[model samples]
Target: MTMVRLDDAMVLGMNGAQRRAVREALVVAYPSRGRLEALLDGLDRSLAHYAADQLPLPDAVFAVMAGAKAEGWLPLLLAEAVAVTPDNRQLADVVGDFQVGDFQVGAATTGRAPTTPPSDWAVIGALADEFPDLPAARPLISQAGLPPGRQPAWNVADAETFWSEVHRLLVDGAVVDGWPKVLLAAHRARPANPVLAAAVSAAGATGNPGWREISGRP
Candidate 1:
């Protein structure tokens, strides 16, 4: 309940109630024309801090931001947020959730409904551009299909050939060639396939060198 300033590190360690209290304090302090700007600035600083440290931001931050989104400035605030930290995956997700109007959890699920006219296709397009390999961005690309050239054809003759291509792409260190996108596409097509799921999981654990080892690379 203390009114200390909430920063990325401080918010990360707070429990849900404590986080809520901080958000409430923010609302009280910035009650007028400054409200949305203050909220967006805090969010930008938090996201920038995490991105600079190369660390993952916790869901708590997004939870509070979602609460703010319900106050009817979702698009403008989120668009500016994403513009400031486009590479932040967690921020991308918050934008994606509102874009699709999927407010199943967090403060968004409370009695306060999200403002109508959810994020438009332009915002979704920006997210897809920043995170082409992210599964979250895939669906937002277009109902017709994945983005141009990024889509894997998956036209192999057999299951073995399909997996062979996947493995080759991984082992050859073709990550820059969009191998992760291919792996994610495969997982989406066959969500029940354990191997595909594991590959997607492994691809995400990029810190582990085992997945990046090239047999003969100098």
Candidate 2:
């Protein structure tokens, strides 16, 4: 494998292995203790935000909708914002515009008018450009297998099925809401399955804050 320099910007076109190698190179590229500390701080902040369940949206959604409460669907919107801006402030701005009709979410498919459009890609691209090395974020839900107006059913699915579906969702890098609850429910369903227990523990270690929150871990 070619040891690409950490400074390489050509990573945008590199294969998955190359990208993984480049990320690993960061440790050697910034050898200073101070640099490493700064890097650690940045990683912590980003991971915490990414793993968080409720990303704060603009206060305007409630203001405009008049008692419009956040439903399970709202996290789907926030996940879309997170695909672009992981920071609460930036996410708030994107979501603010989203709520108020300034930022538009386009649908994944075209031909007929979509019930809800996907997150605005132009804005997401602009944000990705500003944030170095940030992979464009995607919604937690997959556009595939979706009916025109229906929501995903993974939320209420049984443990085995939820396990399979959630695994597919994460592997595909799609966003999912209430994953912790799903996991806990799965655990409850298979309390005696040591393999499942181990898998659940490993899932939480992925730096998702919501996992711990729902699992009752620190």
Candidate 3:
């Protein structure tokens, strides 16, 4: 069977609307709804259809998982969960057979940056300032070599917007260490940031509700 996949563009396109739809669907799919494994199974089963009445279930499921800041093992776990499904069964018995100890949910990484820069000098400079450790940010900062406190008079508002894109890239799978902590710093820098909020909310939905508590919001 072909495994379901979510690409960069699709994951980046997730928004509040899709998140809400998935949540509602989950409530119905798993009424007991306590286990993360069950939720993962439901999501995988839902995606087998991929589309229902024009609503894209895979996109919504990916939106939720990516927002959750799941580790690199997520794809591996999903693959394992789906693989065990009985050919004669309707829905999978993933949760019953799942053995968390059998898998390692290690650090997530997006691999590398593109050879070509995607942002303008000002935006890149601002990102470098914000996340100096980021792989993509480092090269831009080096090439521009804009002195400290000498960045172009770019619009600060646009920096916030761009930071959302950066957040998406990181959580979606960057060589991030302590991803939750990184998210906290991002939220601190930009209070009420939608992207940050979405990221936090995603993490909350997937058993790790720490982001919600740290952000001090429901």
Compare the candidates by TM-score and give the number of the best one. 2
Q: Write the per-residue lDDT of candidate 2 for residues 70-114, one digit (tens) a residue.
A: 222323323333343332232233233223232323211332232
Q: Give the TM-score of candidate 2.
A: 0.22
Local error of candidate 2 at residue 81 (angstroms)? 48
lDDT of 1 by residue, 42-88 (tens): 54533343223221121223444564444443344444544544433
Instruction: List lDDT for all candidates, in order.
Output: 0.37, 0.30, 0.36
- Model 3, range 16-97, lDDT digits (tens) per residue? 6754433333322322212223545554533233223222232344444554434333434344434433231111222212
As for TM-score, the candidate ahead, 1 or 2, is: 2
Task: Name the lDDT value of residue 105 in candidate 2.
Answer: 31
Clash count (model 3, backbone only):
3
RMSD of 1: 16.4
Give the Å shift of residue 20 in candidate 2.
39
Q: Estimate each model's TM-score.
A: 0.21, 0.22, 0.21
Question: Per lDDT, what order, best first?
Answer: 1, 3, 2
